[model samples]
Target: MSAQRKLSSIGGGQKTHQFVDDSNRFEELMRLGHSDVQIRVVKYGEESSGRRPLVILNSIDFPMPPSEQFCDRMWRARFRVVFIERPGFGTSTPLPGVLLQSETIRNGAASMAEAAILQEVFRRLALEDFVLLGMGSANSVCYRLAMICPMVALAIFSNAVFNQNILDVFRPNWFQAMLRQTIQSRAGLQIASFGVKYRLRRNPEGFYGQVLQKSAGDLGYLQNNLADFERGAELFQGIEAQTIEYDLNMSLKPDSLLKDGLFETTNAVAFSGLETTDHWKSQLNQEAKRLSIDVEYAPNGDLYAPYASPEFLLKVITDRLNRLGAAQSG
Candidate 1:
């Protein structure tokens, strides 16, 4: 059967269709809220499995839909994996006035706006109880979701900086430091976004090479996995420049979801790459302690742990799910 026809047989009308050339996954553009913003949702695994949902928020740097390989792995593990493209990324419509006011972006309004959209997504998908998985900067949104979405049974972050100030405390490379400064003003962010788009369009391989150079571990993995690297570069290049600016603006700010008692009702864990700087590891450790969650280090892992250490990530996730199951049964 044709992919579209096959997907149509599964239900949900035109809103859901097979992802381009990928039979194992389907994408849906859901119209959400009064503003009629369209949120693109990608689904993996069989809905009939009745497994608890695994909702993933991918890193802003590569804010693309989950890969076919990743989706197959999750499906084999019996997870109904759903990847939601954050507002402004992928085909999802940007939140209204996302770039208009720096104050709104800084004062937690952006996070709240995203959280509200996510809440509606969960409702629409009937994801009453699910595990939340976040990668890198996207973990900031995960925090806001965990705070407001009572249905989040567990939250996991991979290579995330919970506190933006940690960059200052640890002092990243000059390039990384300068990248953070782009968010201080709308103009700076737009300019930086334009530069990124230009570089990706002009010479994608070089752009990705330069990007991965900072993390030897990730670079090595992608070097051996050329297909994955090319796919990622294509996705990264597909992101809109304005969306890039908005995503960075929200991610670079000090996380406002760290309010008192936010995680009291939520269970959370973190995974960090051993290849990351000691300062980053230190910050992850401290934040894990404050949140009263466990942290696991993936040997030879780096900032791109999601891409480079998928097996390790899966193992950690499976272990946690087993423990949660055990606790609930007990």
Candidate 2:
């Protein structure tokens, strides 16, 4: 994604900046004796460590390389960026090999543990008052984080919804169907992260065409993202006869508590793309309004629009934060 295409490593170190968001601003955080199971983290600028700063979790397993290509400009601005890889994907280890935790207990524990570790990222980094950006799948993670962590200053969610609220004509059932296929095909999903190879699986030409398009067609952003999500265990359903399990067996506990508990300290901004389903567009507006957070819209597709329209988002967020600043000052 970098114009360089191939970046020589700065040192024979893990901290090379291949395509860091705000490329000039980030350095890979050394393991520092922490378990590798802890997700990878990179600071936005060459700042002293031990600051909390704004912690951002990309949706699900989205790669920093590509996101950097698309949205690095935005990430470089306003706030320091902290990128986290969720458990089961990216640099984070999928629950310990030992299944002693049980599917349910382990799932719940991991999310909490992940949140707790994130707080550590803040404390260890020495920054205070965090912000969150959960695009697509990460929206759920952000939602969970807001409920679990009181220190989060703001939460930004894009192209993500709960419980299939938007089943509009703009939606793509076949896209999810493909995920179902990937979930079912043990061989298919393991290689999802492989990108080009996975693109060739069904239609190489068409897939690559979409990637270069920078936005999805009528199928929209979610479809393109589902396509881009180059990683995951073979769709669990791909391995099993049943359909994909939307089990947030890990999510229900925290999410339930969030729904029940009154959320304070954290403010929010919900963004949706016009190309998205009417249901998605409406649902996000209503929810954000109800939650008392600001809501914004993008004319672009779901995936890249948050990225594509970063300027617009920044304006909305900046204006809101300024008002917030004024209220505090007064």
Candidate 3:
């Protein structure tokens, strides 16, 4: 919530977005949870517009002040987007020692409770049809949110990691004192920035270049993404203690949500990276099929496939939204 990118009109009724940096919602929510935390939100599109908004709950790693590419896409599609930085990360307060008590992954869904707050924000603006989308790291929280808050219209996921028995991938001991030390350290921030910049420069195509290839008919779409990563130091500024913990606590459980009937959601669309682990998706496909919902793998992609397959991602989302929308209409 430190800074924001306001809307840039691309002509016609299509409009870019304006973000209210330093949203107070986080502060308010912190009081309610008794969890000393900070949260920042990047509001997109014209909030006043009577459009069905898209609330993108980003992965724990990447925070708000969204990529212009995402904004441009949302703008053109006539959808409003808001990316919020979870507590103890980004501009929010540091993670309290008590955070040391949760399932590590349970902290992942702490924001599920935040849904009530976000709902109030949306309502004040009258953006009634708000659909939720979650990226790789976000799928966990999104799952719980969709489960706990059944009022949500649809849950669209990108590279959902739950199909993997997260417990198999991570463990409590993984939250070693060393990792926590790094997250709270100055060196960790610099390291994260340099690391991302290095990756983007090395594979702009894989990082974000692959996303727009099918739609633009040219490789030029990557230029902006490349630039963002090129200035990775700035694009990835601010550290979130929660994000740091989320990464280290790899084995934390994210599927207990099923017992609560959250996954009973009849409307869900998932697009996963074919190159990534197929298990969580394998599980999702089975579950979706059993529930009569659709789960499809990207024609050809990886964990970052959502970026690589934005068009396909949109189609999946639009399809799910259509079904969910039709249900509401009926």
Total clashes for model 1: 0
Q: Which ten residues in a row have the lowest lDDT in candidate 2?
A: 236-245
Give the Cα-based TM-score of candidate 1 against the true structure.
0.84
The digit string of per-residue lDDT tens for model 1 on 149-224 reads: 8898888877767653555532235446546657666567667666766676677667666666657767766566
* TM-score (all chains, Cα) for each model: 0.84, 0.65, 0.62
- RMSD (Cα, Å) for all candidates, in order, is 3.5, 7.1, 8.8
Give residue 176's lDDT in candidate 1 (0 to 100): 67
Sort all candidates by TM-score, best to worst. 1, 2, 3
Q: What are the lDDT figures for the candidates, one per model?
A: 0.68, 0.48, 0.50
* Alpha carbon lDDT at 308, candidate 3: 52
Q: Residue 248 in candidate 3 has what lDDT?
A: 35
Highest TM-score among the candidates is held by which one?
A: 1
RMSD of 3: 8.8
Candidate scoring better on TM-score of 2 and 3: 2
